[model samples]
Target: MVSELRIGILGAGGIAERAMVEPAHEVEGVRVVAIGARDPERARAFAERWDLPKHGDYETILSDPDIDLVYLALPPITHAEWGIRALEAGKHVLCEKPLSVNGTTASAIADAAAATGRRAFVGFHYRLHSFTRRLLDVIASGVLGDIERVDVDFSIPHFVVKPGNIRLDGDLGGGAVMDVGCYAVDLIRAAWGEPAVESATAVLSDDDPRIDLQTDAVLRLSSGAPVHVRGSFIGDDQGAMSLRIEGSEARLAATSVIVPQWGATLRVSAGDGLLLEEKAAEGDNSYARQLEHLVAVLADGSPSILDVRRGVGTMRVVDEIYRAAGLEPR
Candidate 1:
């Protein structure tokens, strides 16, 4: 067993700074050893700001034997290649989602991880939250008997900002589904266990015909439970994120299911009346919890809940959604 886990940041971007580097300090038995970027000066600035010991190009971090893990915050298109390289270098990888541009690449990453025996975790931090665990427990308890339907919608109006942002680039695997819609799709898969995409329709962006501004998909689980998911990058709605699960006996609804760091509420209703209501306490950081779990997995060879295999399953759904919508997979 390892005494400590040393993590190297492979990208000096916003997610690397806010989600990984900052939250890593709060996780025990892990340290951020170095940061790498295309520009060495930018990497140096990020490393200095985060109080890390070293900063250099990507090769430098990859060559360092002291780094046990690599946190990849690169674009979705680059995830599979860099992830495979990191695993080949005998280092575990925690990559930001969507794991790859398509299902094939995601599967390749999973295969590489298996071959290397290196742990690969996707950055679906919400799965590590206490409230999400409670939500799963409630679902498994059978209180909401026989879930029949699930509705998920996550929309944000911020797509209008930064005209040339990567999220708007079709070649770079940018779209509503690839960006925010992934979370909704992941939530559905988490609840329904990898449903098959029945159908999907998307509204393409006016500026870029290949990119979707909004997408809606219908899926069916093995048990025939139908799930309706909608994601939008540009919408009239006031930035909403919620999920509703309807069962034969009762209904469960949660608000802000995506980023519950601020706080979240779950309400359950039955035929008689409102059955239960719960709210997440303040100071709940999913990133910290996720990092700690990865450290545990690295040190003791424990199973990770959001392993690379799960990432491949999620990406398979994503690829099918694009095909169903009559669009090529990004």
Candidate 2:
């Protein structure tokens, strides 16, 4: 069990900077000391930008005894190989989602973790956000009554114009569903209960039928509540990362559900047909809270919501969605 966790980032991508290194200092006894990438110069530049103590090719950080945990921000195609390697090297892993290109490959990471007695966590940091807690609170209070359905929309234009962006390349494990739909699907499962996909369809890119530019899936909770999820990458007003829960007695809606750090609003309304409750999301970035959770998991035996096993469960659903859409899973 690690008391002080020294982290090495496995990629020099934007997420490693924004999601891992930037929020790391907020967690006690956790420091991002090193970074490694396929390109040594990119890794060195990233390390210098973040003022990290170590940087080099990917093997440099993996072989470092000082790196107790590795946060993998590499492209989805590389997660399984490196996650397994890190676990075998006696280092815990915190991998970015979708964990891997598909569910079957993702399960190997869990297998690796179990065999090595090293934990592997998936980075679904949004679950640690304050709005999530508030959403749960309202549910537990029964103010929303019996849930009737959940609707989620998460889309961004980040890669729409970048023809070479990984998200637009099928070989890089890219797709609208894999990149953003995972969040929508995971959010419902966490905030409510496990769900089973009912039907799904996709709008494939003109250049690549395997690459979904947009995906829409319908799911049902064990409790019989329906879920409508839409993930997009090319359109404005598709679904700007919002969630709504319509219950028998009331309705709850949240804006900016994905990155509440940029500011968010949660509103609940009932029979009166007016706003009954309103809450604002404000707090540390969920990434910091996630790091804290990782520390606790290492210090003791705390279970993690971000477990790779759970991530595999999510990927299975994603794979099902892809199959239902008549496309192949990465």
Candidate 3:
């Protein structure tokens, strides 16, 4: 087992700069040793801006003997290839979400992790947040009775800001479902067990019919409960991210459930019309919690709460939804 994990970050994207790199410094027993990008000069600039010790092309960091872990913040399309490579090189990996473009690639990553005996983690940081933990606790306590239905809405105005962004590109594993619908689907799977896609439909972009701008899916959990999930890119400017759980005995609602690191409010209403609210305490950001968890898995042999296996399950649901909507998987 490893003691301290030396991390090398792949990709110099927005998430790499904002979430993973700085958060690595805050986690004890974790160090950011290098940053790599396809462009050497871009990597150098990112490293210099972050005050990191080393920067180079992707091969430079992957071949470095001292780097025990690699944080892959590249796009979804590149996750499988790089994740497999890192595991084969005897390094643990923390790959960004959606794990891959589809279930097949995700399964390959899982297989590689098993074959190499290396720990592979997916970046579903919201699963590690305090609010999500509390939400799970409340559900487990039966306060919500038998959860009958769930409704989730997570929409953002991505197309408004960057019209031709990669997120709008169908070829690069881009769309509302791949980009944001994964989170909605994950929340459902986490709250209610693995689900079967009953039916799905989507609104394709007017300019680019190949890409989905909005999607609505119905999923049936093993427990017979139904979940309704909606995601969109050309949504209201106000940004909608909320969840409601309806049960036989009570109903629970939460705001800002996605990015609860800023703040979140949970309300529990009983059959008698009484209401209660619980607010999450300020703590380490989600990325730090995620980093700490990865370190623990590397140092000891703790099982990841949101492992690649679970990611594969989620991707299967995503693929099915696209097919039902008469569109191909990204």
Candidate 4:
């Protein structure tokens, strides 16, 4: 029997409650032993609810010699520091995305991972979704031929309404681009394969304390494929999130691809008629899939499907996009 991997979860917040603990409990050969939070009462409550051991400070979990892994569920601003510390402490780390706020901190985290020879993974959860997996397989198979263009649309109307939510504070690494917009950017990179950003432009809300709450940016890839991305946190309603890939032989429409409805079929049309249409199985929660992958990397030294190298590359592109848009790092 394979031994269960011991895991420590940082940040006993909603994201952890929804994305990590709840789903992870179903995966075999994984054990979440400890949960950490800044507030002792909050941490204890979360721990009791999840049936997990409690730690008031994050350092306690990282310094625990028996814990094999640490999950960083904190804000974007805290990712780099905790990631580096965890890696140096001989613990593998799985950090939630954007990896870090900007390229500088991301680079530092990547450097620490390299220097420590530790397994580090990022939580770009969308990539593990069934619809997206199929999309990647189709693109990589060259069934659509040489790619010409890609269009991505994203909008989230109901963001955090908490008065002191880190997502709204620029100093705390808050912004549409860093938070939600990065998903579109990441998808573009996954499709284009190592493309550099040519330029970016953004429009901010009137007297907005944070960076632009909406962004429409055009990216010119080195492969000559141009990507158009639209993202916003404030919208009339939640706009449709989709991706259209135009290639030499035909065009593939991934309508409502981002949050694909379960039991609904995804159609790939060839303009003349339907080419492929299939309903994806809503099996294996993405959080579970990512955790399994992280465990495989730690247990047998397997390569991470979404490792730090990719995380750093994604952050660099986002950093450049911010620079082009005249949004200075906070």
lDDT of 2 by residue, 1-330 (tens): 777889998989888988889888788989999999889999889988889999998889889999999999988999999999999999999999888889999999999999999999999887787767776677668888898988898878644536777888888889999999998878877777678889898988888778998899999988899899998887574448788989888898888777777667788888777655555445658888888888898889788899999999889888988988888889
Best-to-worst ranking by TM-score? 1, 3, 2, 4
lDDT of 3 by residue, 105-196 (tens): 99999999999988787788988888889888887788778989988888885546366788777767888889889988888878777889
TM-score of predicted model 2? Answer: 0.95
Clashes of 4: 0
Error of 3 at 241 (Å): 1.6
What lDDT score is found at residue 241 in candidate 1?
A: 79
User: Where does model 4 exceed 4 Å of error?
Assistant: 158-164, 205-208, 255-265
* Cα lDDT, all candidates: 0.86, 0.86, 0.85, 0.76
Which ten contiguous residues of candidate 4 have the minimum total lDDT?
256-265
| Candidate 4 lDDT by residue in tens digits, 43-141 | 788888888865667888988987887889898899998999999999888888778988788888889988998777788876776777887788788
**Which residues of candidate 2, in runs, are more than 4 Å off?**
158-161, 237-239, 273-276, 281-283
Better of 1 and 4 by lDDT: 1
TM-score of each: 0.96, 0.95, 0.96, 0.92
Write down the TM-score for model 3: 0.96
